[model samples]
Structures are given as structure tokens and as C-alpha cells.
Target: MENRVEFYRMSKTSNPKILNRITEQILKAGFSGNIKVYDLGLDDEASMSLIVEGTYENEDCCVAVGYGMNRQNLAIRKKWFRHAP
Candidate 1:
């Protein structure tokens, strides 16, 4: 998962089209369905986890997609998450 993020980031060297293609491939590996992209953030140093209020399969499939994005963000951009101005 994390590796995908790195690849996604590195893809900037190639082109946006290639990055989008790679993203599509990652999503297709899982069952096509609703996916919510969320951010894990902190408030005053308090930790909070993203909650998905719905049913999910235990196949590690959907989670894998999320794991890739989240893991990568945490690994490479832990301190650069978005903040409202």
C-alpha cells in the first residue's frame, strides 16, 4: 500500500496521465464500490482515527487500498497534511 503512494508520488516525474492510470489499477484490484477518502489528523496533539460507518469485507482488499494511501502519506508527508487557513 505505502509503496503505491511512493510510486504515485514518483510518477510526477513521468506524467499525470501515468499517475492516474496507476491509481485506477490500484482501485480496480478491489471490488468496485463506494470508497471514502479521509484524512487522519490531530487536534492539540490528540490522535484520532478515521471511521467508516458501514460494512466492509474482511478480505483485506478495501483496507489494502486505504492502507496504501494512508501508509504512504504517513511515511512521506506526515508533517505536510492539509490545514485550513
Candidate 2:
């Protein structure tokens, strides 16, 4: 099966601590492969949006990550979407 890519929008704080925390959370939730967390510029609310891409064992894992991030105040832009590249 192909790897799944998920997207999320977080507060405009892209500090190393935040990035590391996100990466750690994803990995702890059973995500595999390299995880990339970068700012995708600003959103409509003027808050900095972040794009988190990684491979997971299943969609449920992604959902769990999203919820976890949400609890941390990261708004999930979309869940379980395909990334064309």
C-alpha cells in the first residue's frame, strides 16, 4: 500500500521545540518513515500554517495524531488526504 500523507495547521510558532514535540508525538503514535514539519506560510486567520507529512501504519494512526495535535492547539486542516507529487 502507498504511504499516507496528512496535513495540519499549527500556530505560527515553528520553533525547534514545537517541531520536535510534533515529530515525537507522531512517532509515538506509530508513524513510520521520515516526518517533515514545515511552515506553509499563513492561513486565512493570519496564523502560520504547518504541513506535517509522514508515513503511518494506517489511517487510524493519522487520525490519532491529528487529535493529539489538536489537543495541543494545532488545527487540523484536513485528515487523511492524498498528496500529489
Query: Which candidate number has the best lDDT?
Result: 2
| Positional deviation of residue 49's Cα in model 2 after best superposition, in angstroms | 6.0
Model 2 residue 57 lDDT score:
59
Candidate 1 residue-wise lDDT, 1-85, digit = tens: 2223324223112456644553454344432344333333321222222222111332322232222332322111221222345
Cα lDDT tens digits, model 2, 1-85, are: 4333333454565466656666655566555655555555554443445555565555432232232334444445555654454
lDDT for each of the candidates? 0.31, 0.49
Please provide TM-scores, in order, for all candidate models, with all chains considered together: 0.26, 0.43
Q: Show how many residue pairs clash in every candidate, following the order shown.
A: 1, 0
Best by TM-score: 2
| TM-score, structure 1 vs. true | 0.26
Question: Which ten-residue region of model 1 has the weakest summed lDDT?
Answer: 73-82
